[model samples]
Target chain A: MIIQTEALRREFLVGTRLRRRRVTAVEDVTLTVARGEAVGFLGPNGAGKSTTIKMLTGVLVPTSGRARVCGLDPVRERRELARRIGVVFGQRSQLWWDLPLVESFDLHGAIHRVPAARYRERLDECVELLDMGGFLRTPVRQLSLGQRMRGEVTAALLHSPELLVLDEPTIGLDLTSKERLRSFLSEVNARGDVTLLLTTHDLPDVERLCRRVVVIDQGRVLVDDELAVLRQQFAGHRTLVVELMEPAPPLLGLTGVVDVTVEAQGLRQRLEFAPGATTAAELIAAVARHVELRDVSVFEPSIEDLVRTIYLR
Target chain B: MLAPYPQLMVAGYRRYASYRQATLAGLATNVVFGLLRAAVLAAVVTQRGTVAGYDLPASITYVWLGQGLITVVMLWGDQELARRVRTGDVVIDLGRPWDLQAAMLATDLGRAGHAVALRLLPPAAFGALLFPFRWPERPTTWVLFAASVGLAVVVSFGIRFLLNASAFWLLDVRGVIAVWGVVGGVLSGLVLPLAWFPAWAQAVLRWTPFPALFQSPIDVFTERGDAVGVLATQLVWAVLLLLAGRTVLARGAGRLVVQGG
Candidate 1:
C-alpha cells in the first residue's frame, strides 16, 4: 500500500482557557490506498478532510492511531516520507514568491535531492505537460492564479514521488483551466506510476480523474467505494421534468415514482423516480399517456447530489 | 544533507535580491539614521574628548556600524515566520524534508549576506567619506569582525526563531514583536554603545546574548577590548541560542497548534 491508516484520529483544544473543549477533527479514519490507485476524498466544508490530509502528510501528528505513508511512519520518519510523496495544498504555494517560476522548481529539486540530470529531465517533462513554458520566467507573484497552480503542481512532481496528494487543486480555477488541469492529472494517473490522493469540492474533477471515491462527514467516513458503485448505491433517484400542454393534476400513482411536484401553474411537473425500479423511457411513456407533453427533460444524478444524499443518510 | 542548505541559501539570497526598491529604500533609511546617530554620539565624544575609551572616530564608527549591522542582524521587523504560522503556511515548512531550524538559519544567512553588500557597505562608505571613521588597523581585525557579524546573524536568528515560534501558541505575534522591537534595540546596543552604560548595567547586559548580537561586532570592528575574547563570547552565545531555538522549535512543533485550521 502506498498509504494506510488504522483508527486514525486527531483532536484540537479550542475556546478560551476557562472553558476549553476538545473537538475531534478526524476520528477512526481507517483507509488504505494501493499503489497507482487514484482516489478522490470528498467532504463538505469543515468535514475533517483537511485534518486527515494534514496527519497523513506529517504536518500534524495524530492525537491517536497509526498512519504509514510509503511504508514509513509519518511522524517518526517524516523526512523520508516527504521524499517519497508529493503534496500540493491548493490554498498555499510552496514556490518562492519573488523568484521566477522555474527557480522554485529548481529549488524544490535541490531540496528533494533529485540529481541534476533527473531534475532537468523531470522539469522539462512537467513544463511540457503543464504547458508552463510561456510563464516559466515570470515571478510567481505576477502569474495568474491558474498559472501559479500549474507551477505548484510542477514543483511537487519534480522529484517524481511515488504518491501525489493534492488538496483542492482546482479550487477557484476558471472552467478552461480546471479542465486542462484535470486532463493533465488524468494523463499522469493513467501512467500507473504514481498513486493519486486528491481532496476537492469540484465533483467533475473526481468524475474525470478518480476511479474510487471516499466521502466523509462529521469526522467519519460515510462511504468508501468505487465511483461507479458510489453513484449506484446512493444516487438512486433521477428527476424527469415534463412541460404539459395545459394544466394538469400532479403526476402521482406512477410506478417507481417516489415524489412529484407541480409548477408553472400546473403546466410543468417534476417526477422523481428510482432509476433501478423504472427506466426513464418507461416513466416518460407513462407520463406521455397521462398528458400531451410539450417538452421533456431527464436529469441525471450529479456527484454533488450523491454526496448530499450520503450526508443526509 | 549539506548540499541543499547551500542551495537554500542561494534561493534565499535571490529571493531578497529581487526587491530592488525595498533594498534601496532600506539603504536610504540606514544612511539617514546613521547620520542622526553619528551626530548625537560625536557630540558626546567631542565634548569629553573620549568617553568609555571611545575616541571621536571610534564613536562615529560605532554609529555607522550599528546602522549597517542593524539590517544584517535583523533585530526587528522580521515577522515572516510568525505571519506564516498565523496563516498556517508553516505547514509547508514542516512538510519539507529539511530541518526547519537549519533551513531558516541558512536562508537567514543568505539574507544577511545581501544586507552586508547593500545595507552594510554603503552606510560605512558614506560614514568614512563624510565623517572621521575609525578604520580597523589590523587585517585580522577585519577577519574577526566578519566572524563576529556572522555569529551575530546566527544568534539573532535564534532569538527571532523563538519569537516566531511563539506564534504556534499565540496565533498573533504582533504584540510580541512590538515588545521585541523596543527591547532588542536598547539591549543589543543599537541605540548606543554598551560601553557608555554604567559598570553595573554593562555587567548585567554582558550576561545576556543581546550584546553578542550588536555590540560585539562593533567592538571587533573598532578593535576595542580583547578581540579574541569578544569573538569567543559571541561564539558561545551563538551556540547556546541556536540550541535553545532548536529545542523550542521541536517542542512547538510537537504541540503545534496550527492556526486557521
Candidate 2:
C-alpha cells in the first residue's frame, strides 16, 4: 500500500483552567489507499478529517497507533517521506506572498533537490496544465483567489511527488474557477501516476473525481463504500411536486409514499417517497387519481442530499 | 550537504528587500537614534573626559556602531515563527524536507545581510559625517569586528528561535516577546555598553550569552577588549546557543499545536 494506517488515534487537551477535557479528534482510523487511486475523505465539521491528514503528512504526531506514508514512518522519517508527497491545504497558501509565482516554483524545486533539467520540464508542464502562464510573473498576493490556488497547486507538484493530498482545494472558488480546477485535476489524475487523497465538503468534487469515499463523523468511520453504492443505499429519497387546477385532495396513505404536504390553499402538494419502493409512474398515477394535476415535477436526491441523509442518520 | 539552505536565504533576502518603504523608515529611525545617543554620550565624555575608558570620540563611535548593529542583531519583535504557528502555516513549513531550525537560521542570515546594507551602513556613514567618529586603526580590528557581528547573528537567531518555539504551548506570544525584548535589550548591552556597568555586573554579563550579542561585537569594533578573546567568546556562545535552540526546537516539535485549520 502507498498509504496505510493501523488503529490511528489522536486526542487534544481542550478547555480552560478549572476544567480540562481530553477530546479524541480521530480514533481507530485504520485505512489503506493503494497507489494511483483517488479517494474522497468526507465528513461534517469536527469529523477529524483534517486531523488524520495532519498525521499522515507528519505535521502532527499521532497520539497513538501507526501511520506510514510511502513506506516511511511519518514522524520518525518525516523529511524523507516529505520528498515523496505533496500537500496543499486549501485555506493557506504555500507560496511566497511577495515573490512572483514562478519564483515559488523554483524555490520548491530547489528545496526538494530536483535536478535543474527536470525542474524546468516539470515546471513547464505545470504552467501549461494549470494555464498559469499569464500570471507567472505576478506576485502571489496580487492574484485573484482562483489564480492563486492554481499557483499553489503548481508549486506543490513541481517536485513530481508520488502522492498529492488536497484539503478543500475548491473551498472558496467561484463556479467557473471551480469548473476549471476540477478539469485540471481530472487531467492530472488521468495520467494514473499520482495517488490522490482529497478531503472536501463539495459533493460535486467527489462525484466527478472519486469513485470511492470514506465518510466519517464524530471521530469514527461510519461508511466506507463505492460512490455508486453510497448513492444507491443512502440516496433513496425522491420528491414529487404537483400544481393542481383546483383544490387538492389528500395524496397521503399511498403505497411507498413516506410523507405528503399541501400548500397554497390546496393549489399545490408535495409528496416524498422511496425511489426504490415506488416507480415514478406509479406515484404520478396515484396523485392523478386524487387530484386534477395541471403540472408536475420530480426531484432525485442529489449528492448533497445523500450526504445530508447519511449525516442525519 | 547544505540542501535548500541557500534557496531559503535567497527567498528571505528577496522578501525583506522588496519592502522599500519599511527599509527607508527603519533607516530613518536608526539615524535619529544614533544622533540622540551621540549627543548624550558626547556630553557625558566632555564632563568626565573619560568614563570606563570611553573618551568623546570613542563614545561617539560606540553610539553610532550600536545604531548600525541594531538591525543586524534583530533584538525585537521577531514574531514570524509565532504567527506561523498560530495560523497553521507551520504545518506547511514542517511538511517540507528541510530542517526547520537550519532553514530559519539561513533566512535570518539573509535578513541580516539586507539590514547591513540598508539599515546599518547608511546610519553609520551618516553619523561619521555628523559626529566625532573614531575609525578603527587596525585592519585586523575590522576583520575581527565582522567575525563578531556574524557570530552575534547566530547567537541572536538561537535566542529568537527558542522564544518563537514557545508558541507551541502558548497561544498568545506577544507577552513573551515583550519580556524578551526588555530583558534582552538591557542584558545584551543594546541599551548601553557593559563597560559602563559596575565591575561585578560587567563580569557577570560577560559570562552570559547576552553580552556576546551586542557588547562583545561592539567591543571588538571599538578595540576596547582583546580581539581574539572577544571573538572566541562569541564563537563559543554561538555554538552553545545553537545546541540549546536545537534542543528546544526538537522538544517543541513533539508538542506542536498548529492552532488553526
Candidate 3:
C-alpha cells in the first residue's frame, strides 16, 4: 500500500479555561490506499475528514495508533515524508500572494531543491495542462479565485510528489471551473504515477473521479466500499413521472411504490419506488390497470441523494 | 535537509522591497520622531552640558541611531506568525520540510538587511545633516557596532518569536503583543536613552536583556561604552532567547498536534 493508517485517532480540547472538554476529531480510522489508485473521502462538516487529511500530511499528529504515508511515519519522519506528497487545502493557498505566479513556482522549486532542468520541464507541463500560460506572470493577489487555485495546483506538483491529497478542492468554484478542475484531476490521475485522495462534499466530483469511497461521520467510519456497490445497495430509489391522457382515480395500491403525489389536476402523477423491488415495466403495467399514460419518465436517485440518506441514517 | 533558507531569505528580501510606499511612510515617521528627539536632547544639553557623560553631539547621535535601529530590529508589529497561527494557515508552514523557527529567522534577517540599506541609513544620513552627530574615534568601533546591531536582530527576532508563539496556547495574541509593545518600547530604550535613567535604575536594568537590544548598540555607536562587554551581553542574550524561543516553538508544535491543527 502507498498509504496506511491503523486505528488512527485524534482528539482536541475545547471550551473555556474554567471548563475544559475533550472532543475526538478522528477515531479508529484504519485505511489503506494502493499505489496509483483514486479514492474519495466523503463526510459532512466536522466529520473528521479534514483532521484525517491533516494527519496524513503530517500537519496534525494522531493521538494514538499509527499512520504512514508512502511507508514513512507521518510524524517522526515528516520531513522526509513531505518530499513524497503534495497537499492542497482549498480554503487556503500556499502561493506567495504578492509575487508573480512564476516566482512562487520558482521559490517552491528551490524549497524542494528540484533540479533546474527538471523544474523547467515540469513547470512547462503544469502551465500547459492547467492552461495557465496567459497569467503566468500575474501576481497571485490579482488573479481570480479559479486562476489562483490553478496556480496553487501547479505549485504543488512542481516537485512531482507521488501522492496528491486534496481537501475540498471544489468547494466554492462555479460549474465551469468545477468541471475544469475535475477533468484536470482525472487527467492527472490517469498518469499512473500519482495516487489521489480527494475529500469533498461535492457528489459529482466523487461520481466522476473515484471508483471507491470511504465515508465517515462524527469521527467514525460509516461506510467504506466500492462506489458501484454502494450505489446499488443504498441508491436504489427511482422516481417515475407519468402524464395521463385524462383525469382518473388515484393509483394507491401499486406494489413497490413508496410515494405518489398528484399534479396538474390529476392529469400528471409522480411515483417513487425501489428499483430492485419492482421493474419499471411492471410499474407501467400496474399503472395501466387504472389509467392510460401519455408520457412516462424514470429518474434514478442521484449520488447526492444517496449520500444524504447515508448521512441521515 | 532541503535547506530552503537561502531561497526563503531572498524571497523575503524581495517582499520587503515590494512594499515601497509603506517603506517610505515608515522612513518618514522615523525621521520625524528623530528630529523631535534631537530637539529635546539639544534643550537638555543647553541646561546641563553633560548628563550621564553624554555631550550634546553624543545625545543627538544616540537619538538618531535609536531611530535608525527601530526598523532594523523590527521594534514593533510583528504579528505575521500570530495571524497565521490563528487562521490555521500555519499548518502549511509546518507541513514544509524546514524547521519553522529557523526559516522565520532567515526571512526576518532578509527584512533587516533591507531596512539597514533603506530605512536606517537614510535617517542617519539626514540626522547627520541636521544635528551634531558623533563619529567613533576608534575605527574598530564601527566593526563592533555592526556586530552588535547584527546580534540585536537575533535578540529581537527571538523575543518576537516567543510573543507570536503564544498564539498556540492563547489563540489570540493581540493582547499579549500590545502589552509587549508598550513595555518593550521603554525597556529597550526606543523612547529614551537608558543612560537618561537614574543610576539605581540602570543597575536594575542591566540585569534584564532589554538594553542589549537598542541601548547597547547606540552606546557602542557613540563610543561611550566598552565594546567587548556590550557585544558579549548581546551575544549571551541572543543565545539564551533563541534557545527559549525554540523550546516555545517545539511545545507549540506539540500543542498544535494535540489540538488537531
Candidate 4:
C-alpha cells in the first residue's frame, strides 16, 4: 500500500480560554490506497478533508491513531516520507514569488536532492508535459493563476515521488484551464508510475481522472467504492420533464413515479421515477397518454447530484 | 546532503535582489537615520571630548555602523514567518524535507549578504566621506568584524524565529512584534552605544545577548575593548540562540494549529 490509515483521528481546541472545547476534525477514518491507484477524496466545506491531508503529509500530527505513507510513520518519519511523496495545495504557491518560475523548480530539485542530470531530465519532461516552456523565465507573481498552478504541479513532481497528493488543484480555474489540467493529470495517472490522491469539490475533475471515490462528511466517510459502483448504487432516480399542450392536473399516482410537480401554469410537469422500476420511455409514454406533449426531456443524475443524495442520506 | 542550504541561500539572495525599489527606499531611510543619530552622538562626544572610552570619531562610527547593521541583523520589522503562520502557509514550510530552522537561517544569511552590499556598505561609505569615521587599524580586525556581523545575523534570526513561531499558538502576533520592535532597538544599542549606559545597566544587558547583536560588531569595527573576547561572546550567543530557536520550533510544530483550515 502506498497509503494506509487505521482509526485515524484529529481534534482541535478552539474558542476563548474560559470556554475552550475540543472539536473532532477527523474521527476513526480507516483507509488504504494501493500503489498506482487514483482516488478522489470528496467532501463539503469544513468536512475535515484538508485536515486529513495535513496529517498524512506530516503538516499536522494526528491526535490519535496511525498513518503510514510510503511505509514510514507520517509524523516521526516525516522527512523521509517527504522524499517519497509530492503535494500541491491549490491555494498555496510554493514558488519563490520574486524569482523566475524555473528558479523555483531548481530550488525544489536541490531541496529534494535530485542529482543534476536527473533534475535536468525531469525538468525537461515536466516542462513539456505541462506545456510550461513559454513562461519558464517569467516571475511567478506575473503569471496567470492557471500558469502558476501548472508551475506548482511541476515543482511537486520534479523529484518523481511515488505518490502525488493534490488538494483542490483545479479550484477557481477557468473551464479551458480546468480541462487542460485534468487531461494532464489523467496522462500522469495512466503512466502507472505515480499513485494519485486528490481532494476536490469539482466532481468533473474526479469523474475525468479518478476511478475510485471516497466521500466524507462531518468527519466520517459516508461511502468508499469505485466511481462506477458508487454511481450505480446511488443512481436511484431520474427526472422526466414534459411540456404539455394545455393545462392539466399534476401527474400524481402514476406507476413507478415517486413524485411530480407541475410548473408553468400546469403546461410543464416534472416526473421523478426509479429507473429500475420504470424506464424513461415508459414514463414518457404514460405522461403522453395523459396529455398531448409539446416537448420532452430526460435528465440523468450527475455526480454532483448523486453525491448530494448520499450526503443527505 | 548539504547541497540544499547553498541553493536556498542563493534563492534567498535572488529573492531580495529583485526588490530594487524597496532596497533603494530602505537604503535612503537608513542613511537618513544614520545622519540624525550621528549628529546627536557627535554632539555628546565633542562636549566631553570622550565619553565611556569613545571619542568623537568612534561615536560617529557607532552611529553609522548601527544604522547599517540594523538591516543586516534585522533588528525589527521582519514578520514574514508570522504572516505565513497566520495565513497557514507555514504548512508548506513544514511539509518540505529540510529542517525548518536551518532553512530559515540559510535564507536569512543570504538576505544579510544582500544587506551588507546595498544597505551596509553605502551608509558606512557615506559616513566616512562626510564625517569623522573610525576605520579599523588592522586587517585581522576587519576579518573579526565580518565574522561578528555574521554571528549577529544568526543570533538575530534565532530570536526572530521564536517571536514569529508564537503565531502558531497566538494566531496573531502584531502585539508581540510591536513590543520586540521597541525593545530590540534600545537594548541592541541601536539608539545609543551600550557604553553610554550606567555601569549597572551595562552589566545587566551584557548577559542578555542583546549587545552581541549590535554592540559587539560595532565595537569590533572600532577596535574597542577586547575584540576577540567580544567575538567569542557573540559566537556563544549565536549558538545558544539557534539551539533555543530549534527547540521552540519543535514544540510549536508539535501543537501546530494551522489557521484557515
Candidate 5:
C-alpha cells in the first residue's frame, strides 16, 4: 500500500480554560490504499474525512497508533514524505496572492526542490493538461474560482508526486467545472502512474473517477472495497414502477420480486427485486401481469444512498 | 540533508518584495512617525539647546533614523507564528518540506530587509532637513553599523519568534502580542533613545536584549562606539532565544490536535 494507518486517532482541546473539554476528532481508523489506486473518501458533515486526510498528508500528527506514507513516518520524516505526496485543500489556497499564477508555480517548484529541467517539463505538462495557459500571467486574486482551482491543480502536480490527496476537491465548483475536473481526474487515474485519495460529498465524483472507495464516519471506517462490490452490498435493490390502467391487484408473494408497495398516487404500484434474479424486463413482465399495465420503468438505488447509509451508521 | 540556505533566503526575500501594498504602507507609517519625533526634538532644542548626550540636532537625527528603521527592525509587532497557529493555517505550514521555524524566520527576515531599505532612506533625509546632526565621520562606522544592524535583526527575529510561539499554548494570543508589542517598543527605544533613560533604569535596560535591537545600532550614526559591548550581549541573547523558540515549536506541534486538519 502507498498509504496505511493503524488505529490512528486525533484528539482536540475545546471550550474555555475554566471548563476545558477534550473532543475526539478522529478515532481508531485503520485503512490502506495500494499504489496506483484511485479511491474515494465519502462522508457527510463532521464525519472526520478532513482529519483523516490531514494525518495521511502529514499535516496533523496522530494522537495514538501510527501512519506511514510511502513507507516513511509522517511525523518523524515529514520532509521525506512531503516529496512523495501532493496535497490540495479545497477551502484554502497555497498561492502567493499578489503574484501571477506562473510565479506561484515557480515558487512551489523551488520549494519542492524540483530540478530546473524537470520543473519546466512538469509545469508545461500541467499547463497543457489543465488548460491553464490562458491565465498564467494573471494574479491569483483576479481569477475566478474555476480558473484558480485549475491553477491549484497544476501547482500541486508540478513536482509529479507519487500520491495526490484531495479534500473536497469539487465542493463549490459549478456543474461544468465539476464535470471538467471529474474528467481530468479520471484521465489521471487511467494513466496509471499516480495514485489518488479523493474526499468529497459529490457521489458522482466517486462514480466517475474512482473504481474503489473508503467510507468513514466519526473517525471509523464503515466500508472499504471496490465500488462494484459496495454497490452490491449496501446499494439495496432496484425498484420497478408500473402504471396500470386500472387499480393494481396485490402481488404479495412473487417468486422473483421481494416487495410490492402501493404508490401514494393510487394509480401505480412499485416492485423491488434483487439483482440477477430478475432483469428489468422480467420485473416489468411480472408487474404487468397483475395490472392493466400502461407502462413500467426500473430504477437502481444510487451510490449516494449507499454512502448516506454508511455515514449515518 | 538540508538544502542550500542562501538560495532559500533569496527566494524568500523576493517573495516579500512582491507584496506591494504592505511595503508601501510600512514606509508611509514610518515617515509619519519620523516627522512626529523630529518635531518634538526640534521644539526641545529650541528651548534648552542641548541635553545630556544629544543636542537639539542630534536628537532630531536620532528620531528620523529610528523612524525609518522601524520596519528594518520590525518594532511594531511580531505577527508570524502566533497568527498562523491561531488561524489554523499552521496546519498547511507544519507539513511542508522545510522546517517550520526556520522557514518562518527566513521569510520574516526577508520582509524586514525590504521594509528597512524602503523605509530607511527617505526618513533620514527628511530628518536631516528638520535638524542638524553629524553623519558617520569615518567610513568604518558605516561598516560597523551594517554588522550591528544584522545582529540587531537576528536578535529581534529571535525574540519575536519566541513570543509568537507563545500562541501555541495560550488562548488569547492578541493580549500576549499586545503586551509584547508595548514592552518591545519601549525597551528597544522606539519611543526614545535608551541613552536618555535614568542611570539605574538604563543600567537594567542595557542588560536585557531590547537595546541591541534598536538602541545600539541607532547609536552607530552618532559615533557612540562605546556600546559595542552591549550589541555583543544582544547577540548572545539571540542565540538563546533561537534555541528556546525551536523547543517551543517542537512541543506545540506534538500537542496540536490540528482540529480542521
Candidate 6:
C-alpha cells in the first residue's frame, strides 16, 4: 500500500482548566491506498480529515494508533517518509516567500538531496506542465493567488515523490484557475505512479479527478466507495421539471412522484421520483393527461446532490 | 561526508532571504543595542583610563562586535527548533533521511551568515568609524579572535537549540527563552568586560561560557590573552555546550508528542 492507517487516533488537550479532556480528532481511521491510486477524502469541517492526513503524511504522530506511508512508520522513520511523500497544506505555505520560484526549487532539491541533473529535468517538466513560463523569476509573495498555487504544486513535486497529499489544493480558486489546475493534476496523475490522497470540499474536483471517495463526518468514516456507487446508493431518482403549456390543474395524489413542488407561475411544477419506482413515461403521461404541457425535461441528480446526501447521512 | 556544506549553507541563506525584512529588523535591533553599549562603555572608560585589557577604543569595538555577532549567531528569538517540535514541523523533519540537529544547525548557519553580511558588518564598520581602534597587535591574536568568534557562535547556537526544544513541554516558550537571554546576557560579557569585573566576578564568569562570548572577542581585539589560551578556552566551551545541547535534543525528541491538527 502506498498509504495505510490502522485504527488511527489523535486526541487533543484543550481549554485552560488544566483538565485532560480527551477530544479525539480522528478515531479508528483505518484506510489504505494502492500505488497509483487517487483517493479523495471527503469530509466536513472539524471531521478530522486534516488530522488523518497529518498522521498519514508524518506531519503528526498518531496519539494511540499507527500509520505507515510506503511501509515506513511516521513516528519512528519520519525522514524516510518525508523523502517518499510530498505534501501541500492549502492554508499554510511551505515556500520561501520572498524568493523567486527557481530559488525555492533549489532549496527543495537540496532538502530532498536531488541530483543536479534530476533537479533540472524536474524543474523543466514542472515549468512546462504548470505553464510557469513567465513567472520563474517573480518572487512568490508577488505572484497572484492562482500563480502562487501553481508554483506551490511544482515545488511539492520537485523531488518526484511517490505519494502526494494535497489538503484542498483547489481551495479559493476561480473557475478558470480551477479548471487549469484540475487538468494539470490529471496529466500528472496519468504520467506517473504517484499515489494521490486529496482531502477537499470541492465536489467538482472529485468528479473530475477522483473515482473513489471516502466520506468522513464527526471524525469517523461514514462511507467509502466509488463516486459512481455513492451516487447510485443515495441518488435513487432525479427531479423531472416539465413546463405546462398553460395553467394546469394540481394533482394532489400521484404515484411514482414522491413530491410535487409548485412554481409561482402556477403553470409549471417540479416532480421528484424514486429511481426504480417511477418511470419518465409515467410521470410525463400523468402530467400530460392531467394538464397541457409546454415543454419537458428530465434531470439526473447532480454530483452535488449525491455529496449532500453523503454529508446529511 | 559533510554532505556538500555549500548547498546547505546556500539553502540557509536563501531561507533567511525569505524573511529578509524581519532579518533586517533583527539586525537593526542588534545595532541599536550595540550603540547603547558603546555609549555606556565610553561613559565608563572616561572614569578609568582603561578597564581590563581594553582601552576605550577596544571597549567600543567589543560593543559593536557583540551587536554584529548577535545577528550572525542568532541569540535572540532562536526558538525555531522548539516551534517546529510544538507545531509538528519537526515530525516531517525527523522523518527525512537527515540528521535533525544538523539540518537545523545548517539553517541557522545560513541565517547567521546573512545577518553577518547584512546586519553585523554595517554596524561594526560604522562603530569603527565612530570609535577609536583597539585591534590585535600580533597575527596570533587575530587568529585567536577568529577561532574564539567561531566557537562563540557554536556555543550560543547550542544553548539556543536546547532551550528552544523546551516547547515540547511548555506551550508559552517566550518567557523561558527570555529568561535564558537574561542569564546569557549577564554571563556572556555583552554587558561588561570580564577583566574589569572584580577578581571574584572574573573567577565566577571565567568558569562559565559567558567569557567565551564578549570577553574572548574583546580579549583578542585588545591582545589580552595568548593564542593558546584563547583557542583552548573557546574550544572547551564549544565542545561542552554541543554535548549538552545534543543530550537535551535526544531527550526532548523522546518526549515529542504532537496534538491533533
User: Which structure among the candidates has the greatest TM-score?
Assistant: 1
User: What would the TM-score be for candidate 3 when compared with the true structure?
Assistant: 0.90
In candidate 2, the residue pairs with backbone N, CA or C atoms under 3 Å apart (3 or more residues apart, or in different chains) clash, namely none
Clashing pairs in 6: A78-B95, A78-B96, A79-B94, A79-B95, A79-B96, A80-B95, A244-A294, A245-A294
Which ranking of candidates, highest TM-score first? 1, 4, 2, 3, 5, 6
The TM-score between candidate 1 and the true structure equals 0.92
Weakest 10 consecutive residues of candidate 5 chain A by summed lDDT: A247-256
Q: State residue A284's C-alpha deviation in candidate 3, in Å.
A: 11
lDDT of 2 at B25: 91
Tens-place lDDT digits, model 6, residues B1-261: 124346667777876776767867877777778778888888888788877656788778878877777666666677767777666666545545567677667766776677768877888888888788566667777667667767777777777876787777774588988887887776777667666668887788778877776667667766775757876888898788778877876777655555434
Screening candidate 5 with a backbone cut-off below 3 angstroms (N, C-alpha, C), the clashing residue pairs are: none
Q: Per-residue alpha-carbon lDDT of model 4 for A234-290, expressed as tens digits?
A: 886788999999999898988899989889999999898887788889888888888
lDDT of 5 by residue, A120-157 (tens): 88788778877888999888889989888887777777
Candidate 1 residue-wise lDDT, A1-313, digit = tens: 9889998999998899999999998977999999999999998988899999889988899999999999999888888888988999899989999999988887888889998988988889888888999999999999999999998888888888899999999989999999989998899889999999999999999999999999898788888999988777889689999999999999899999999999999999999998788988999999999899999999989988888888889
Interface RMSD, model 1, angstroms = 2.4
TM-scores of chain A, one for each prediction: 0.87, 0.84, 0.88, 0.85, 0.87, 0.86
Q: Per-candidate DockQ versus the true complex?
A: 0.52, 0.49, 0.41, 0.55, 0.40, 0.38
- Candidate 4 C-alpha lDDT tens digits along B59-91: 989999888888899988889999998899988
Clashes of each: 0, 0, 0, 0, 0, 8
Each model's RMSD to truth, in Å? Answer: 3.1, 3.6, 3.4, 3.5, 3.6, 3.7
Using DockQ as the measure, what is the rank order of every candidate, best first? 4, 1, 2, 3, 5, 6
The DockQ-based CAPRI class assigned to model 3 is acceptable
State model 4's lDDT.
Answer: 0.90
C-alpha positional error of residue A156 in candidate 3 after TM-score superposition, expressed in Å: 1.7
Residue A228 miss distance in model 1 (angstroms): 1.0
Task: For candidate 2, write residues B105-139 as lDDT tens digits.
Answer: 99899889888888878888887888788888898
Q: Residue A106 lDDT in model 2? A: 79
Fnat of every candidate, listed in order: 0.65, 0.66, 0.53, 0.74, 0.47, 0.35
